[model samples]
Target: MTKTNAGRFFEDYAPGQVIHHAVPRTIKMGERALYHALYPARHALYSSDQFAQACGLPFSPLDDMIAFHVVFGKTVPDVSLNAVANLGYAEGRWLVPVWPGDTLRSVSEVIGVKENSNGKTGVVWVRTRGLNQHNEEVLSYVRWVMVRKRDASSAAPETVIPELAKVVDPSDLVLPKGLHFDNYDFTLAGEAHRWDDYDVGEKIDHVDGVTVEEAEHMMATRLWQNTAKVHFDATVRPDGSRLIYGGHVISLARTLSFNGLANAQMVVALNGGAHVNPCTSGMTVRAWSEVLDKAETSVPSVGALRLRLVATTGAPFALRGEDGKYLPEVLLDLDYWALIPR
Candidate 1:
C-alpha cells in the first residue's frame, strides 16, 4: 500500500473519498490543566469532579473545543496538508460531550471538489465526524480547504462549490444534555462580564502571549491521543520539522480571549476560521477580538456575540497589510459566536 504524502496536492483529492485520517487521540487531565492555564475557563462542569458528579457525570470532561481539535487535527494529514488556505466551515455541531478520558478518532468524507480556473489550486469540502472509543459520534462538522494543485498546467475540472450558512441559528445551538447551571459559581468562573455587557462592534484585547515550545505541543498532542507523524514523529517529515497542531493555536487564541471576553462562555457557532501561517516553536502567541454582532438568546442570563479573533506571533495589535495581504506573523483569523453573560 502506498502512503499519501502529508503534503498532499489538490489533484490527489476526489469527491466521495473517505479519508480515515491516521492517529487516534484520548483526552486527559494534563490537557485539562493546560486548558485551565491557557484560558480562564472555570466552568464547574470542567473544573470539579464533585460538580460533574452532581451534574450526573463521574468526572469533568475536557472543553468542547478541545474535543473538536482532537478530532479535527487528525484530518489535517489527508484534508489540508498542502492546503493553500482553509476556505471555511459550516453546520458544526457537538453531538455528545467529551469526558477527560475519552479516546477520539475522526473520519472525513469528501462531499465536493472543484478545480480552479487558474489550474494551480482546487477546493475540497469534507464532513468530518469525531467518534469516541465507544464508537459514539461526539462531534461533526463540514469544512473546506483550498488545496494547491501538484500539476498547475492541467486543465481545470468542473466547479462544485457548496452553499454554507453565515451564522448557526441560536435554536441550532446544542447544549450538552444536563448542562444546567442552577448552582453555577460566577466567582470561580472568573470575571463579572455577562451577556448584556458586550455591545456589537466592541473590541477586546486579551493581553497575554504564550510562548510555545515543541515539548508543550508534543505533550498536548499526546494528551489528545493525536499521534500524527508530522505532529510528533519528527523523522517522518522531510524537513524534520514537527508541525505544531493547529488546535494548539486555536486553543491558545480562545484561551487568550478570556481576558476581556471571559464572559464569552460557550462557543455556540464557528462561522469561519483559518490558521493563516505555520506556528513553530518559540513563537509567542497573542490574541485580540472584535465583536461583530450581538443577538439575544432564550437563556436570559447569557447573550450571544459574534466575534473575530486574531492570533499573531510578534505582530503588534491591529492587523495591517503593507502589501494588501495579512502580515506574515499573523497566525490565524477566526470568526465565531460565543455565549456571554447577560
Candidate 2:
C-alpha cells in the first residue's frame, strides 16, 4: 500500500464534490503580531482593544485578512497544489468577526469546471467557507484557479461554468454584531475623512511604495501555510523565478491605502479581484484607489464604500491600456466594499 499522498489535479474535480480541508488552526496574538510586521497594517479598529470596545465589539478582533489567510492556507493543499495560477475571486463575504483563540477550518465545494481548448489545463471554481470551532461560518468566498491536468491525453469533463454575481448587493453586507460607529474616534483612527466626505468617481494616490524582498514574501507565504509550488519552487515556472502570492499584493495595496483612506476600516465584501500580472521579488509596489460608489447601511453610523484598489510597479493609477487589456505594469486590480464611519 502506498503511504504517500499527491494533491488534486484538474481532472480530479467534479461539480458538487465537497472537500473538507485538514489542519484546523487556532489563531492567537502571535499571528496578529506577525501580520502587522509583515504588512504596514495600522487600522485603528484592528489595532486597539479600547478602540474596538468603544465601537461595541467585545474586544479587538483579528484583522479580517488574518481570517482570510488562515482559511486560504487550509485550502491550498487540496485546491491549488497543482494550480497553474489562481485566476480571480468574486462574491466574498465576512460573516463573523474572528477573535483570538478561535480555531478555524475550511470546507470547499467544487462549483464549476471548464476545460481549455488546449486540453492541457482547466479552470475550476469552488465556493469555500471558513467555520469556527462551534461550526459557525465566519467567511465565505468564490475563487477559481487554473490547474494542470495530470494526464494531457485524458478526456475533458463537461463544462459547467457558474454564473457569479458581478457585485455584492450593499444591503447584503454583514455588519459585526453590536457595531456602531457613532462614537468612532477619528484622531485615534489616524484620518478625519468620513464616508460622506468621499464622492463617487474620486481618486486618491496613496503616495507610498515598498520594494518587495525575496525573504519577506517567502516568510509571508509560509506564515499563511500556503504550499503552492509556484510560490516556492523556482523550477515550477519557465522564468525560473518564484511567483509572489496574489494575496500578498492585496494586503500590501490595502495597507498602502491607509495614507488617504485611513477610516475605510473593515473589508466586508470582495466583489471581484484579479491578479492582472505576475509579480516577483524586487518590484516596488505602489497603490491607488478610486471611489466607485457609496451606500448607507442599516447599522448606526456605519456606512459602506465601494472602491477599486489598484497595485502597480511602473506608476500609480494606470490600469488597462488602449486594447482594454491590463498593462504590463499593473499587478493587481481589486474591487471590494469596506465599512467606514458615517
Candidate 3:
C-alpha cells in the first residue's frame, strides 16, 4: 500500500462528490505579520484595532486575502494537486469576519467536470467552503482547474458545466455584524475618496508597482501550507519555471490599490475572476481599477462599490486585445464588491 498521497487525476473526479480537505489552520497574528511583510497591505480596518473598533468590529480581523489564501491553500492537495492551471472563479462571498485565533478548515463539492479535447487534461469545478471551529461558514467560492489525466486512455467523464451566477447581487452581500462605516476616518484610512466620489466607469491608476521575486513568493506559499507541486517543483513544468500562485497576485494588486481606494474597507463578495496569464518571478506587477457600479447596502452608513481590479505587467487599462482575448501582459482580472463610506 502506498503511504503517501499520489493526488487525484482528471479521471478521478465525478459530479456530486464531496471532499473534506485535510488540515485545519489556526490563523494568528504571526500570519498577519508575515502577510503584511509579504504584501504592501495597509488597509486601516486590517491595520489598527482602534480603527476596526470605530468601524464596529471588535478588533482588527485578518486581511480578507489572507483568509482566502489560507482557505484556498487547504484545498490544493485534494482539488488541484495535479492541476495544469487554475481556470477561473465565481460566486464568492465572505460571510463572517475571521478573527486572529480562528481555526479554519475547508470542504468542497464537485459541482461539474468535463474532459478536454486533447484527453490529456480536464476541467474540474468545485464549490469550496471555509468553516470556522464552530462550523460556521466563513467563506465560499466556486473555482475550476485544469487537471492532467494520469493516463490518456482513461474514459472521459460526462460534461456537466455549472451555470454560475454572473454577479453577486448587492442585497445578497454579507456584511460583518455591527460594521458601520459612519465613523470611518478618512485621514487614518489614507484616501479621502468616499463612495459618492466615485462614478461608474471611472478608471483609477494606482500608480505603484512591486517587483515579485521567487524567494518571497515561495515563502508566502509555504506560509499558507499550499503543497501544489508546480508552485514548488520547477521540474514539473516543461519550461522550468515555477508558476506564481494566483492568490499572490491578487493580494499584491489589492495592496497597491490602497493608494487610490483606501476607504474600500471590506471585500463583501467576489463576482468573478480570471488568471489570464501565468505570472512568474521577476515580473513588475502594477494595478488599476475601474468603478463598474455602486449600490446602497442595508447598512445606512455603508455603501457597496462594484469594481474591476486588473493586475498587469504591461500597460494599464488595456485588458484585452481586439480579438477579445485577454492581452498577453495581463495577469489577473478580478471583479468584486467592497464596502465604503456612503
Candidate 4:
C-alpha cells in the first residue's frame, strides 16, 4: 500500500464534488516583507499603517495578492498537482481584507470538466473559495486547468462546461468595511491621478521592466507554498526548464502599474484573466494598462476603475494580432476593478 498521496487526475473529478484543501496558513508581517522584496509592490495603502488608517481601514492589511497566493497555494495539492497548465480565471472577487494574524484555508468545488479529444489529458474547472479561521469567505474565483490522466486508456467523464459570468457586475463588488478614501493624500500615495482623471480606453505604459530570476521565482513559489511540479522541477518539462508561475507574472505586472497608477489601490474584483504565453527565467517582463471603464461606488470618496493590465516580454501596447490571437510576446492579460480615490 502506498502511503504517499497522488493528487487527483481528470477521471477522479466529478461535477459538484467538494474538496477541502489542507494546510491553513497564518499570515504575518514576515510574509508581507518577503512579498515586497520579491515584487516591487509599494502601494501606499498597503505600505503604511497611517496611510491605511487615513483611508479608513483599521490598519494596513496584508497585500491583496498575499491572501490570493496563500489561498491559491493551499489548493495546489488537491486541484492542480497533476496539471499541465492553468488555463484562465473569471468572476473573482475579494470579499474581506485579510489582516495579519488571520489564518486562511481553501475549499474547492468541481463545477465542470471536459475530456480533451487527445485522451491523454482533460480540463477541470473548479470554483475555489478562501476562508479565514472564522469560516468567513474572503476570496473566491473560478479557474480551469488542463490535467493529465493517470492512464491514457481511462474512460472520459461526461463533459460539463460551467456557464460563468463574463464580468462581475459593479453593483456586486464588495467594499472593505470602513474603507472610505475621503481624505486620500496624493502626495504620499505617489500619484495625483484620481478616478476622474482616467478616461475609458486610455492606455499607460508603466515604463519599467524586471528580469525574471530563477532564484527569486523559486523563493516566491516556495513562499506561497505552490508545489506545481512545472514551477520547480525542470524534469517535468520536455526542455528541462522550470516554468514561471502565472501568478508571479500577475503580481509583477500589478506592481509595475504603480509607476503611473499609484492611486489605484485595492483590487476588488477580477473580471477575467488569461496566461497567453508561458514565461521563463531570464526574460524581462514589462507591463502596461488600459482603462476599460469607471464607476462610482457607494463609498463617500472611493470609486472603481475597470482596467486591463497586460504583461509582456516584447514591446508595450501590442496585444492580439489581426487574426484575434494573442501575439507571441504577450505573457498575461488581466481584467480587474481597482478602488481609487475620487
Against the hidden reference, what TM-scores do the models get?
A: 0.80, 0.99, 0.99, 0.99
- The lDDT of each candidate is 0.75, 0.95, 0.95, 0.95
- Tens digits of lDDT, candidate 3, 156-179: 988999999999999999999999
Per-candidate Cα RMSD to the true structure, in Å, reads: 3.8, 0.8, 0.6, 0.7
Model 2's lDDT to the true fold? 0.95
lDDT of 4 by residue, 1-342 (tens): 899988888889999999999999999999999999999999999999999999888999999999989999999989998999999999999999999999999999999999999999999999999999999999999999999999999888889999999889999999999999888999999989999999999999999999999999999999989999999899999999999999999999999999999999999999999998999999999999999999889985999999999999989899999999999999999999999999
lDDT, candidate 1, at 47: 70
What tens digits encode model 2's per-residue C-alpha lDDT throughout 238-281? Answer: 99999999889999999999999999999999999999899999
Over 4 Å off in model 3, which ranges?
Answer: none
Q: Using alpha carbons, what is the TM-score of model 1?
A: 0.80
- TM-score of predicted model 3? 0.99
Error of 3 at 293 (Å): 1.0
Could you tell me the lDDT of residue 163 within candidate 3?
Answer: 98
lDDT of 1 by residue, 1-342 (tens): 867465667877767788887778767777778767654455545677776555445567678788887887788777876765566677777768888788889999888889876778899999899999999888888888778888888766656676777767767766556544454556766777766677777878788888988887887776555545557766755677777777788888887887887656567667777777878788889999988888876655456788899999854466658777778888888888776555
In model 4, how large is the Cα lDDT of residue 14? 94
